[model samples]
Target: MVIADLFKKTEITVKNIELGEVETLNELTPEQLQLIEKGLQTVGFELLDDKRKQIVQKIKTIIIEIVQNQSKILQKINPSVYIAESIGRDYKYLTTLFSEVEGTTIEQFFIHQKIEKVKELLVYDEYTLSQIADMMYYSSVQHLSMQFKKITGLTPSHFKELKANKRISINQL
Candidate 1:
């Protein structure tokens, strides 16, 4: 939204500019571009000017969706398929770019995100491990517990007893 606001102050009008998040604007003076860059920096945002970086951000956005929402899309399609379709690229290319930029596979990132969600849900205490596992599409509670411990170095049950979160923000992950 801030990106949109930044563009509004200049001649640039973005119909669709997902790549690099601002890769190809209509037109803007050098002064306008400088002003927009400075504004973004002041607000703790930066223009992602590289296509590879843009892809990485897109992948992160999709994974965050999986972690935060039990959406119909997630249930209806496989993650690789969903991501590939969403971004109009082959999954292999996306995976390679993600690993090169992030130094971790997409699956690992998804697991980390899923574990973080598990921690949040555990703190809420509204659902049992079984329920959380089911909602998250884990084949079984054991599978979810194994992944949770592998990522966080603690079992879900132990994590619950602590009444604290070891999860990081989605952006950090």
Candidate 2:
């Protein structure tokens, strides 16, 4: 009876694996390339060819590191300085590369990520709009609202209301 149960468990595990429910590192050689492909697919973005893709990947790493340290770093760091210092590449080169590969300026990409973070903060409802603006380093709540409306076509209040109704995934941004 125990042997039969063990066999059944093994069969079910095999079925799950066959159905793509199980993931393993062996399935993903060249891990960095796999990650880049997956990230683009997740966000409905397209990958450039290998060389351009690598450049974009580096830019993304810079963005991610900055954002992760946003609270500590943003207060003292201007965007240009942040880009230059963190990326170890001249700001002009990085911006030109980002624009060539992404079809958007680096500033535009940064704004998009900021807007996405604002959306997430608004959805949480933990912070007031003013507090969100302050935390995110906007000059004022009005400034935050203006940018939010410009990018999302909704005011912060309206966004929070809609968020109450239906949530949007930040990754999908």
Candidate 3:
């Protein structure tokens, strides 16, 4: 709630909190916006006033939530459709804009995030490879292993054996 607190401190009422949005009850003055933006910067958060950037962030947030939190929902829906439906935008525009801004396809970013999750599950040592694959929505353990190797340059088994802190932060993904 750092962002909400920042806005509250500036006497701005946060009406909603979505991944890339913080809706306010009223318009913020230039000075109030500046103060809130500065506060956000101090905490390594940015005020994405640009509409295009906000859309990109929303796309990232949806993918992250699906991969990292809503595994069951992810298994039930296609990400492209989900993103389009969630943001009320065409998937083609979203994909093109995301590629232009982030230098990677949305699909690639999703794969990276999934592999990162796999790495985390591997490190946890609480699940078998098969179970991890199932949890991650892989068709089979072999499929999971193939994709994991392709993305990480190491097999899941090897990654676990190394026991190195190889997981990437979701923000960096």
Question: What TM-score do all the candidates reach, one by one?
Answer: 0.83, 0.65, 0.88
RMSD in order of candidates: 6.3, 11.0, 6.0
- For model 1, the superposed segments whose C-alpha errors exceed 4 Å read 10-25, 164-173
Residue pairs in clash, model 1: none
Model 3 misplaced stretches (Cα beyond 4 Å): 164-173
Q: Estimate every model's Cα lDDT from 0 to 1.
A: 0.84, 0.69, 0.89
Which residue pairs in model 2 clash with each other? none
lDDT of 1 by residue, 34-124 (tens): 8888988987888666788888999999889877996567678999999999899999999999999999999999888888899999998
Give the per-residue lDDT digits (tens) of candidate 3, residues 27-54: 9899988998899899998888989888
Q: List the candidate numbers ranked by TM-score, top first.
A: 3, 1, 2
Distance from true location, Cα of 36 in model 2, Å: 12
Top candidate (TM-score)? 3
Ranking by lDDT: 3, 1, 2
Best by lDDT: 3
What is the number of residue pairs that collide in model 1?
0
Which of the two, 1 or 3, has more TM-score?
3
> Which tens-of-lDDT digit does each residue in 1-173 have in candidate 2?
33223324433222222211233333334654455455556556554556656666767766756654555578888877877786587889878888888899887787778888888787778989888887788899999899999999999899889778676568866
